[model samples]
Target chain A: MRQNSHGPIGVFDSGVGGLTVLKSLMAHLPHESTVYLGDTARVPYGTKSGEVVTRYSLKNAEFLLEQGVKLLVVACNTASAVALPALEAALPIPVVGVIAPGARAALARTRGGGVGVIGTPGTIRSGAYQRALEAADAKVRVKSRACPLFVPLAEEGWTTGDVPLLTAREYLAEFAREGVDTLVLGCTHYPLLKGVIAEVVGPKVALVDSAEATAQAVAALLTERGGLASAGHAAPTHAYYVTDVPERFVEVGARFLGRPIPAAEQVDLTF
Target chain B: MRQNSHGPIGVFDSGVGGLTVLKSLMAHLPHESTVYLGDTARVPYGTKSGEVVTRYSLKNAEFLLEQGVKLLVVACNTASAVALPALEAALPIPVVGVIAPGARAALARTRGGGVGVIGTPGTIRSGAYQRALEAADAKVRVKSRACPLFVPLAEEGWTTGDVPLLTAREYLAEFAREGVDTLVLGCTHYPLLKGVIAEVVGPKVALVDSAEATAQAVAALLTERGGLASAGHAAPTHAYYVTDVPERFVEVGARFLGRPIPAAEQVDLTF
Candidate 1:
């Protein structure tokens, strides 16, 4: 009944944005095979209701579980905020979400206890990061804002353009006013706009890349479970599945992953 | 069976964005009732494939037809661009889409032969506006740009901020360089950013709002079909439906509709 060291790690996002998490996973655990599912057919789950996102997250997890994964990563912040608990309770494999790891990292980075969290409206409204950070250290004050424009900016490949920078300044002005010492890149897409975000927040504030934090948590969990991929294993494989093709998912995904994705299998999952 | 003159007109969009079109319809045909469907579960048709958009659009039409509507409006611009033909062919009722009306208005407004069209990536890439303009007048040159950021800016209620003005300038500078005398607001959300867009593009360019144009088209079509609600009919009633509930569709929808949405019925449609 136990998961073996050889099974691939399962990761899923609403769309290619979660490639940020997969990139970090590849960096930290190159020996492990990963299977990623992007629900490109119905993306931007961040804008949907908790029930809808939960239903989708469960279905995505089910598809990966069917593929025999050793662990599961809900790489989307909105799903992590609203659906992580349900996924953890349902899935047999160890489940990791981006929220807790990012919260832990932000809590560790902030010297003055003031921490800022930026994400989608759904994620921010769920109060997942604030709850997680407060649960970690009640003394840490969490100031959260939803920079809804970042998703479209990242998708447009305008991360460094004046528009994104101006948008970041507009979204982050409140956090700067509050003098938060640390900020969590709560959504995967935010990492792509890190330059603008960092500049807007200034060098004094530590920017925590939740995707990187998630990878670290995933690594530690695999090691604890004795499910880490053994060294000398055949070259690790990264497989992608999306609900919609002809979407240039492979093209946009390449930008997010920082490498070419030759192809991704088109998939349809029923919830 | 013939559809009754009293039945509500059906309208569907990828999501709440269609409310803008519905609002225009309310003003243009005050005696006619409306049934609006927002496919919130699978929104942002702006990024999906032509075939997929067509399939979803057909399903949306079928659901509306089942409710006994007199006419159908494809309020989503991406749907109008990619799926309008199929919808027009399949639906028995008179079908109207937002594209042709917007294109016609732009063609009429342009004196310099240079027309600029701005929409979502899917709408722009479909070349629907360009082809529509060229079909009407052979010599009218068309320039199209995908202002992806405008959707988010409008939704975030940042339609007038410095960020939106800067983003508009960034997106519209090319149109200025090309000396476009007429610009079509090819997507429903773009109309909300009219102030910023107008300032960026200057006074010489005429802005055509697709929602308003579509409303006019629907009015003319209903009259041609003799399906217009009889004069002296009671004040119009508008009903709303969405695939995802608690999505703040009602709240965000108010901005798009320019009036509060009292409620929306959550629905699940089978394609």
Candidate 2:
């Protein structure tokens, strides 16, 4: 049961939001194959309790591990916030969660100013990003807000115009007032609303995309461990699995992944 | 075992939104004891597939039925839309869903003008309301739109104000332009946004509250079947259950139920 470099990288999200991370991973490490599991049957872990999210995350990770993945990626922010420790302990493979990478990027980007983290209720409530930022630097000031509507807006493709603009302003006005120089896009879906978020927070605040940071971190970890897939393999295959019907995942997932998903195999995590 | 006349009515929703329907049911049927089950672990069935929703609804119904209830109420609009037939066929007790009653009320209220129905994507996509409305009268015109943000907005307590007003205007403008004289507040959570919706749609268009309609429907069905709980039964105990932690449910559920939910016991639906 030794970890092999040829095995696919495992990535999971509560739902399609994690596709952003998968997309980044694909771009960052072209030679690595990937197996993605979208826990569609019980999605939006953002509003659920820590125990419930952890249980669900464990199931998702187990399913991904069965696919012979070398490393596990907790792509969902809510899971990354609440279940990362559990995953790290339970999984034999190395686990990369989006929170730490995003936090590190935010800390590095901030210029002696505070940092703001925006995400779902559960993620913000967990204070994972806040803790990560503060843990990295004792003097780092962190402010957090829960933007529950952003996921729905992004899925509905309402990222632009008045509705999103007003929503972004309402959620980020305090961050702007607090003079935060870097705002971490704590949730994967938030990257889609980058323009509106940037517009609301103004020019000074640097936006850290968790997807990009996590992908880079993953690449670095694999490179250092000598687990990177060799480049001579047939164009790295990407396989998708979901706990529910594949239609919605393929449709909305395209928005997050920035490409077409022809099909996704149906999976049942009940076992 | 036979469904007893004095037994509590069983109600289930994906989450707290159906508390609105429960609120009306409590008001309209004061003598009836009730057991409400919120599927908080996998909440927001709005955007999920029909098969997944029906499966969840069935599990929810089974849990409620085990509570020894006389009647079943599909309080969630998405569940009511897609799972009514299966629920009605599988359960021994009579099942009441919000869609049929709301459609009937809309049919009665509309004065030669078209009817507009607004709800979650799953409910709208199922075309349940449109089918029900048109089935009653072949000549009646119906239009349905999914307002995905409304649920999150309601949960966030952003029921009124410029953002919701603008969102309302954006969603309702088409109905206004198309001259729909009546709009059916198809989703249980939408009753919370009545003020903003009313203002946006104007005075001429009467908005039908499905919760009120559904409550009356349940009352009539129970009365007809001689299943109404007798008045002497310990002030009609109202028990609440959820699949996840009760904190968020109790907090946001108060808004939907129009009062307090002192506590909600957690239950596992994994089997």
- Cα lDDT tens digits for candidate 2, A1-271: 3358899999999899999999999999999999999999888888889999999999999898889999999999999999999998999999999999999999889998888899998999999998888889989988899998898888779989999999998998999888999998988889899999999899989999889889999999998888999999667899999998998899889978999998999988854
- Please give me the total number of clashing residue pairs in predicted model 2: 0
Return the top candidate by lDDT. 2
**Error of model 2, residue A271, in angstroms:** 5.2
Question: Per-residue CA lDDT of candidate 2, range B9-69, in tens?
Answer: 9999999988989999999999889999999999889988999999999999999989998
Interface Cα RMSD of candidate 1: 2.3
Q: How does each model score on lDDT?
A: 0.88, 0.91
Fnat measured on candidate 2: 0.79
The Cα RMSD of model 1 versus the native structure comes to 2.0
The global Cα lDDT (0 to 1) of model 2 is: 0.91
